[model samples]
Target: MDPVIDVRNLVKRFRGTRRTAFAPATPDSLALDHVDLAIPEGQIYGLIGANGAGKTTLLKVISTLLLPTSGEVRVLGHDLRTEEAAVRSCLGLVTNSERSFYYRLTGWQNLRYFTGLYGMDRTTLERRARPLVDRLGLSRAMDRDYRTYSTGMQRKLAFIRAFVLETPVLLLDEPTSSLDPLSSEEIRSLIAEECQARDQTVLLSANNLLDVERLAGRVGKMSQGRLTPVESASDLDESLRVARIWLRDPRSRVEATLRTWAGGSPGRPPVRWEVQERNQRTLLRVATEEPERMLPEFLQFLLGSGLAVESVDLRSVDLEEEFLLAAREAEAEASGASP
Candidate 1:
């Protein structure tokens, strides 16, 4: 079966500017580098990456917002270069940036106007959008001016517009960003439900790992303009277990000691540690296959260091850690291949 979205050696470059009036101009920077992707029909393909990893650039190109420098791109068998109108008709796009909306128009008015472009009548638009707005907690502000809407409300309006269009393909860039936990969950649920119910093919680019894990059946990591697909998160790293130790201390001493011990300790289990700030507390994450063995040792070490442990949690390796580990491996491989 042909993929709903297809690409062959796609590349996009942005022009760079001169350093100064008298300095040499910079060369064009490559945004997408010979990238190839094929997302099958009715599949939610999640693309994750750090900022500026070309995730948004790829989506923009697929959505016909930017022209590709070279190679082929096809959406629903329509050539992106030659049949852009066909591609646009078949896909709905929700961008992270909120500037796409008409500030002076009310939220409902904006939705009606955008849906009008898609040939959806006001009645149909209301029927489709009212539920989404209500579900996303934006019903009260539906008639309010868009300029006065909060960042989150503006984003919800974008989603309602896309969903109302009911295109066969949806391109979502950070749909859950800047959303509170409940709102994020609602958006994720809507995404999953909408795709399954409508049999739509969704290409989602997000920094939120949980969104990708929950919504995407097939996952890929985008780094340095290259995409690496994986069967599942567990394939990212051999160590599938993680232990998080919540330390009550707000000081950096705990982090420093952990780093020093991790780097200098001998015969230690193959584990990697990360210190994160959490609500005036420090979270020390230890990734290892042998969490049971490492937990005791870690607890002893922290107590010995005079750092008070608030609590400890043991869980499977989440998508966040998997993303980090995969990135590290990709960087290592790239370095090794460098001449």
Candidate 2:
């Protein structure tokens, strides 16, 4: 299958001015620097990174909101430069920027206006808006004025507006940023269900690692205007050698004992142990490679060293830590540092 979104060596720049004491100087800033990406149809692709990572810039270029300085971008087989109209017809975009809605108009009315612009008939508008409002839990507020709605409610309305036409490709930037936990979960579930049920292609940009881990089929990290693909959530978890261990006894000397063991081991990689109190119990995270092999011998050494033995438990690593480690490693390699 052909990629739904294909980008090759894409570049976008902005010219701005900086003021020195007596004069203003112009500088060229590159928002997207020689980025290459391919997003397959029917998959939820996550674009993740810290702010200023060019997530939004890439989205704008793909959605035809901004022109790239150079390179090729294609959406649904339409060249961004030559077939912008076709691309626009097939794409839906949602961003954190506040959208304007007629304050006096009811939610249903607002949707009707947008649907009319899309040339949707009255019956089709009702058919589409009704299910979307219900799915987004906006049934009660559908008849209320936009100005009276809370920020979260308005955001849900914006999302509903974007999906009303059922565009094949969706570009969402921080779709759940302002939502409460329950609302955020609801929206995420909807997006996931839509992707699976309709084979919709989605590119979601978010800073929330957990959200990406849960919803994305593939994850990519963006930094310095570049994007790099990453292993899937399961693969990332399996690649780590870090393990969390819970001891049976609450001994204050555990740290010293573990430190001695880590220092004495010649061939083993150095282990860093962090002790924390959780639910009034002690928890230790033993960072090392091959935890299964090391745990038995480490326990023995601890016992022989007179450290009280505690019931050992292993903890699972979450997606956030994995992302940070991956990003840091990539940054190090880019800066010519040893792994």
Candidate 3:
């Protein structure tokens, strides 16, 4: 089966500042660095990255809001350069910005006008949008000017419009941004239903790892303009667990020993550690994936390392920890690659 969205050797660059009378010239910055992605039908591909990491840049390039510097992008086999109109017809994009809507128009009016561009009449638009509006808690504000809506309401309006469009592919950037917990969950449910029931392909970029954990079938991390797919523990084995150990008054050698242990022998699970100043005491946090048989031995190793262990918390692995782990790994790789 052909992918619903295909991107190959994609690259995007923003020109840096030119030399001025008092400043030196700067090299161009790469927003996307030869990124390749293929999202299949009915799949939710969740993209997570830090600020300025090129997640949004990739989305905008696909949505045609920003053109790529080079390489191929296609939606439904329609080339983005030659078939932009066709590509646009196949995707509904939900951005966090309220600037996408007309300030003076009511939410309902904006919805009707946008859907009208897609050839949806009033009855069809209302039939498709009303339930989504109500479900997202935008029903009460539908008749008010969009500018009067709060940031969260504006985001809901964006979702309502995109959901009603019924496009085959959905490009969502921070769909749950500015939303409360309840609203975020509602949006997640709606996204899942749209993909599972309607078979719509969704590419979701979000900082909220929960959104990705709950909705995405595949998760990828974007770091320093490169895309790396990673398997979330939730989607993998249920036996995977994260243990966070807090140490009090730990010796300086405690960290070196822990690092050595983490990188020690073959077949050992990876461990990550960080120091924190908490409540006027020095605290050391060590997080690792420990299987049932390894926990006791790992604890003994820590005890023998001459470290004072304060408390240990163990639970199922979560996306938050996975996200942090990926970020730290990326930072480490970049650091090693630097001259």
> Per TM-score, what order, best first?
3, 1, 2
Q: List, residue by residue over 215-240, the lDDT tens digit for candidate 2.
A: 88888878768887867665665555
lDDT, candidate 3, residue 329? 56
For each of the candidates, the C-alpha root-mean-square deviation to the true structure, in angstroms, is 5.4, 6.1, 3.9
Q: List the residue pairs that clash in candidate 3.
A: none
Candidate 3 residue lDDT tens string, 174-270: 8888788987898898889866877999999989988998988888889878897767525643634666666665445555666666555676666
The best candidate in terms of lDDT: 1
Superposed on all Cα atoms, model 3 deviates from the true structure by an RMSD in Å of 3.9
Runs in model 3 lying further than 4 Å from the true structure: 22-25, 236-243, 249-308, 312-316, 332-339
User: Where does candidate 2 clash, by residue pair?
Assistant: 247-310, 248-310, 248-311
Tens-digit lDDT track for model 1 on 18-114? 7897888898888888998999999999998777778999999999999999989999999998999999999999998889988999988888788
| Candidates' C-alpha lDDT | 0.83, 0.77, 0.80
Give the residue spans of candidate 2 off by over 4 A: 18-26, 241-317, 325-339
Quote model 3's TM-score.
0.82
Clashing residue pairs, candidate 1?
A: none
For model 2, what is the C-alpha lDDT against the true structure? 0.77
